[model samples]
Target: MADGTVKRQIAAKVRQAFAPLRLEVVDDSERHRGHSGYREGGESHFRLTVVSDVFSGKRRVERHRLVNSVLAEELAGPVHALNITALAPEEDSA
Candidate 1:
């Protein structure tokens, strides 16, 4: 996968896996320009904020693990850093 499409691919995979009510996948690659793991064309670093019922009753780490499991391939490949904020729908109201 090319750098430009990784975020879209991630959003699709997360939607498939968790069915999040709200999902935002932001590519922060530009912020790390010229740093290690920073690809010249961007899409190296990303931050995901996901709200879903699938996260209900799960611990924070577990939620992260859930996302990590889904994105294992991306993490192991072109993705450099993934900063995730996974939240249950209920928690979002808090």
Candidate 2:
């Protein structure tokens, strides 16, 4: 799928999986331009920040693993890199 489509799917999956109180998915592929795994259409890189109750008791690795598992299809396809910031709702003072 294309960049926009991938972005939409990522957002949809995360929203569905976590029911996050706050979530942001950023496509950072454009900045990678001609870098390896960077496609011309720019959907290969992403940064996701999520705040949810589900992350409350989880370690950082577990949080990342959960997100990675949920987005496995995307990673197996057009997505090349992902940076995730996972936080519990109680941890979010802002």
Candidate 3:
């Protein structure tokens, strides 16, 4: 996948799965240049913050698992790292 396409795919998949009230998908591959798993094009690393009711009663690990499951294909291929900040709407406000 190309740099921009990977990010868009991730955001779209997350949005479809969680229907988050707020979501941000940031490509951090540029910062990982020269590091292991870094690719010529950016899209290998990402930071994701998602707020939704689906995470309201879930544990942190569970929330991450949900996101990971949704992006399993990407993670297995082009994406090297995913830093997720999953939150409920109330937690986001806090």
lDDT of each: 0.91, 0.93, 0.93
Of the two candidates 2 and 3, the one with more favorable TM-score, higher being better, is 3
Candidate 1 C-alpha lDDT tens digits along 1-94? 3446998889999999999999999899889988899988778899999999999999999999999999999999989999999999988853
Of candidates 2 and 1, the better by lDDT: 2
Residue 18 miss distance in model 1 (angstroms): 0.5
Tens-place lDDT per residue, model 3, 1-94, is 5539999999999999999999999999989999999998789999999999999999999999999999999999999999999999989963
Measured with C-alpha atoms, the lDDT of residue 36 in candidate 2 is 87
Tens digits of lDDT, candidate 2, 29-89 = 9888888899887889999999999999999999999999999999999899999999999
Q: Each model's TM-score, in the order given?
A: 0.92, 0.93, 0.95
**Which residue pairs show backbone clashes in model 1?**
none
Stretches > 4 Å off in candidate 1? 1-3
Model 1: lowest-lDDT 10 consecutive positions: 1-10
